[model samples]
Target: MAYRATMQEQMIRKGPWLEEEDERLAAFVTLMGERRWDSLARASGLRRSGKSCRLRWLNYLRPDLKHGQISDEEEQIILQLHERWGNKWSKIARRLPGRTDNEIKNYWRTHLRKKVQEQEQEILQRAINNAVNPQDFLLQQGDRSCEDDKSRTSSDILQISDYGFAASPYEDRLFDWISGSSSGINEDVRKHNEVWNMFSSSSYNLGFVSASGDSIWDYNSSSSSWNLDEDLQVVKQTWNTQ
Candidate 1:
């Protein structure tokens, strides 16, 4: 953190702010609210740019500056404000009480994305774990919805491996999810996916009928069709010789 003003107060010319100069600026803003950085700079006899003064005061000296990782709640406001206004750090900073827009933007770039990725990975891992050794509840769902329909079975059920789930919100619910932009895309994405799954799933329906029902389908689409009464001869040819 470079000092915004020179420290000596040597009545010196401006090159950069020093430690002592920072102390003076702090004293000035403390004595009076930072109404005008230009006025503060001149009155303090620092002779620095008003923008510099403002930035110094706001970014550094203002009795506010909540440093060290903005809270999740504060982060939401920052992202929302940034999205709506777009990179006007000053404007965004105003909406925040003690946070700087630069801090917010930087955090968004470096930390936020990583945080989101980590969270997503955790969710994906959780889902994968659940899929393998699914709890009685999810298992019951499989039993009732998929297995009950003799025409289809959980044996042919799709795994997370079969088709990766993207985090984008499925449309019908975007109206609900985007409404909470402050809450963020990932949160809404989960809700969106849940809703999509709820709607898309009732009874698993196979896209193509196997010409032979007894064949062990490898999910090969081109050779997918097999006779209903007979084992899929194509699949049987490879696995079951009898």
Candidate 2:
């Protein structure tokens, strides 16, 4: 029959820091300097350790600190820099104006870790799919012979110039589709937005065939996709009306 503990070990405090505490810490650090952190903490009337005082001063109390949500471009730059230098946040922070090393380091842990995990999961899923569909990997083109003439005509019409998804899994199929379209699907990009949207990832850009035989229609949006003949008809009617 042991009784419940009389009190919790520690009380949890949240919300914005108080103004008096901020002012006291700021004034003490400014007047006393870094080496005498213990003395400064006691003089300033803040019940914190020397190490905690130093961290708070550099990480939060500093004048040039950037706070709140990081923008997309900032995120991209951080990722690229991190790959180049690994976990050297201080080195990375020097390149980013108005940012701090600790802030950047925390952001990497919170955001970059999740992105890297997602990429790894996507790769793992691809590996699983390839393993399950063993035959799909070996077969380059499903209907190569039946499409020879059609492919040739599509090549003639689309004026297909350059393609980037050349090494894509669907290289042969994409080439065949372009060749068969008589409408000139001369898509000259490795990443075809139209076809790429159908699957998680695509190497082909089979968006459309331009009249000039040098352009291809692309599917670049979430709301639209290709339906071949029927959709093509609807598109033509809509285009004419517009």
Candidate 3:
């Protein structure tokens, strides 16, 4: 019996089913209703194994099986599903009608695999190119000038000017008060002129004020103290007069 079994196994066909074999297998599958492939193979008198017969029927020989180049829409679906499910080809095949797991797997190996790898490499290269060094970033920030900071501050004030008619309300009022007061220099205008003069002077530089830890008000040599509340009240009266 062992000798006979060995002879039978040796006699079994492998690789590339003939057209006659395919016809015979299909007829047997139709009569038997696609179950017990071992028995079906034996009954059909085909030398191919049950697994081989099953694969052939499902992958190619089936009448319902689709055989053509995969469409663009189908290719996109395969890519999306492959990304989500990984190498679950049988699972992926279930989503696509008439496409076998073997066909899908082979397509992925031949076509989609390299495409996916190239995409991953491109993304990695882009990330490598865009990566910023911490030290370089810090040095770039440190290299920025105080003049640039002042210009940015001036630009911010100018941007605020765009929201109003030509000049901001506070700037318009301050300019009007200064222009009007220049003709008849009152006590308030005199104090204002003193403040302006202090700002313009080289001794009381605005640039060094932050570093020196000195107040702009400290430049006042007069014994009379400047109260912010009193100054605000005088400014309100001046605005009222205007």
Candidate 4:
């Protein structure tokens, strides 16, 4: 019995099935029905194993098996189900009529696996792009605010220039004095002070010069001191003449 079993094992074929073997297995399965695969293999008189016979019949020889290319609708279904179940090809195959688990598994390995990985990577990249860091956002806002302030300051300087104040040191000093000291002064007094300060600034050459080129009113002379009443009288005379 042992020698006979060894002989049977030695006679059993392993590898690709021939067309004659396939026909013989199909005939035996039809005659004996699809149970007791070991008995069916022996009865079929084909040197292939019961497991091999069963796999070949179910995957290839079955009349209901679909040999055509997977359709677009079926591909979409496979992708969705794979996302939900993950690697359960047999479970996935049950939902797709006429598709074997082995066929589905091979398709996934060769084609769909890479597609799914690329989709996941694309989704990850998009999420990274949309997620802005809070610190970076604040820095951008701060930079924009600083730019706005610089633009506003430039516009103010331009406006001042348009009004005939050229933003010199003399003008800055005059502006400081007016802002600091002229708040409580009457309008007439403030105007008088403005005129006085303009004359006091060294940059202004408004004083009358004699023929010898000496200033008649040397307001620019540091050593010269004049009474406010006298200065006011001079200013009044000059204004009335103008």
Candidate 5:
């Protein structure tokens, strides 16, 4: 028990620090320029470790530190930079001025990471839901698109095929509707292409069965036509026959 007591006596202070301790830490950092934390802690007359003193100075006592909650812009930057660099908090902190690596790491752990995880879970659930009942999901999206027409620009809204066929028969029809020379087809084509690009880049299988049995999305120069009505009519007639 004597060895344990000696160890305890030698142990540096931990947990919440005092106001005077904060000042001494800050003063030591100001004078010493923060290069040597152990020396700074000794000089400051604090029973705290070098690591603790350094963290307090960098995260709290620093004059250039930004107080208050992170703004939407900062949050967005953090999310994007984290996506690119993974858990390299210091690298991410460089992009966000007045923010410490420790602060960013804490913020990500407490808030942003959970939000991202929840979003991923939601997307996974949607994918599963889509797999189980694709027609229902498409119809729901179609209905929502129609209902929210006034809120979105022409290009921002999800476009469904006007042809009132079931999901299996309407896959190619939807592609044609986007690519064709209909009044709003150009905007629809742009949005559809964006979705297609996202899916392709992510390698997400959307399970789009081609009604034509050739290719549903043939946007190549030779295959693309402003007028695909004749082919659509043939598809319609074939669907009617079946």
Candidate 6:
């Protein structure tokens, strides 16, 4: 016949304490009164180790223990202390009257650390949204300026004629030079200029002109578009009566 092990000869318990163990431990603590843990378990008839008993007392069973969510004031103190001590949790815990180093460390990792990570992610996303695309942004501004110029009156068109050729002879010469030059201008720039000249000349009479009279039109040639009303495109024909 195999002999069953008695409770005294059983393997020492590890992990979660039972209600009976808690009751026995509490009773032992009430009589033996604190610390001296190595002998406390053996004397109390608990199947727990001294370290386990010490931890349970310090973390859960202490009379002054505050049980609930850590307050904001406690969280701030923990952060400040952690900065100074750098994971010296015991040192940090001392500042908080009832909190243990283990509890503070758990709070930092679970709640405070996660909150910081979320805030950092939000900041990074915002920065990406606000960030400018240098090439595209400059082109957008340039296109907007061109749109403003396209709304010019007839007087503005006449003013452009006066300023474009008369004020600067080199302006006409530049075009002539570009057209006839052996070294070709950039094809996109050439096309943009061609579009501008078509609008400005008396032959077309679009009656719209640029204020700056600056040449080099800004547009996305790939998405080149026109919003002209057909009535606005009327040609001026010279009449001869004999």
Task: Return the clash pairs for model 3, or none.
Answer: none
Best by TM-score: 3
Go through the candidates in order and give each one's C-alpha lDDT: 0.53, 0.54, 0.62, 0.62, 0.60, 0.57
Residues 156-191, model 1: lDDT tens digits = 444321332222122212333333332543544444
Candidate 4, 56: how far from true, in Å?
A: 0.2
- Regions of model 4 farther than 4 Å from truth: 1-3, 132-242
Write down the lDDT that model 3 would get. 0.62
Point out the worst 10-residue segment of candidate 4 by lDDT. 202-211
> lDDT (0-100) at residue 20 of candidate 2?
80
TM-score for all predictions? Answer: 0.38, 0.43, 0.54, 0.52, 0.50, 0.45
**Model 3 worst lDDT run, 10 consecutive residues:** 159-168
Candidates' RMSD to native = 18.1, 19.6, 30.3, 38.8, 17.6, 31.2
List model 5 lDDT by residue over 113-221, tens digit each.
9999997677668968668554455456554645633433322222212211222223345445433533442354343444334332211222222234433343211
Higher TM-score: candidate 1 or 4? 4
By TM-score, the candidates rank as 3, 4, 5, 6, 2, 1
Compare candidates 2 and 5 on TM-score and give the better one: 5
Q: Number of clashing pairs, model 5?
A: 0
Across 108-129, the per-residue lDDT of candidate 6 in tens digits comes to 9988877767865776665557
Query: What does the lDDT come to for candidate 2?
Result: 0.54
Cα lDDT for residue 46, model 5?
92
TM-score of 3: 0.54
lDDT of 3 by residue, 1-242 (tens): 99999999997899998999999999999999788999998888899898889988999998977799876656765786576457888866755566889899999999999999998776666555668554343334333633344433433333222232222233234434553455432433443444434333433233223222333233221225545456545665755565
